[model samples]
Target: MKKVDTNKYTKLTLSLERIRGIITELPHNGHRFVVLYDDKPDKQGYIQTILEDDTLGEQSPYLLETRVYHTEDTFSHYRKSCTKAQEIFPYFEDFYKDIPFSYENWEEVTKEFLED
Candidate 1:
């Protein structure tokens, strides 16, 4: 598996209020988000949250999917998938223990990861 660049990704610590703001703007209509961690053993920490949107599929009122992975090492982690925004908070608490909006702050990091 490809390992995350330690120099590029660092542990994120944000205020609870800021975290709440990030969650509030998440579109509940038909978009999803994935919480990712650094794929390093000693450095296992939250890297970024990815948004997954399926706008072209023809389904009857598709629900958003939020996939959370809590990693123990470089290769393994527990997975929790949910659709409701309410269900996502616990995972956020576990990862950040603190606290998104605009996603403007996240765009650069996310794009860099995706492009890699």
Candidate 2:
């Protein structure tokens, strides 16, 4: 028998305005912003992952990129600062928001689904 991964993927849904508010303050709180794109034709929403800048390192200097995922084939981008993060907010659907995750417990919080 093949063992299947039973971990479930979860996402929070909020208004776009709320999402923008959270992104604006990420830099002040020593955090980075991530946007997860949904490729499903019927689902036009996106998922936001907030990660610590220091934990991810500084390999890429560009403000945007094409990949950012661990267990899925979704398109994602990470921004190190508020300004760079906000640049792409306007392109997001007007229906998503993200709450700040504590850096100290980020791993615990994301470990379930983030694990490959």
lDDT of each: 0.36, 0.38
- In candidate 2, position 44 carries an lDDT of 40
Error of 2 at 51 (Å): 8.7
For TM-score, the strongest prediction is 1
Give the best candidate by lDDT. 2
Weakest ten-residue segment in model 1 by summed lDDT: 98-107
List model 2 lDDT by residue over 1-116, tens digit each: 10111012224444566555655555444436545444445444343534334344432221322233443454333323222555546434322223322223122233333447
TM accuracy, model 1: 0.39
Backbone clashes in model 1: 2
**Residue ranges of candidate 2 with Cα displaced over 4 Å:** 1-10, 39-62, 66-83, 94-116
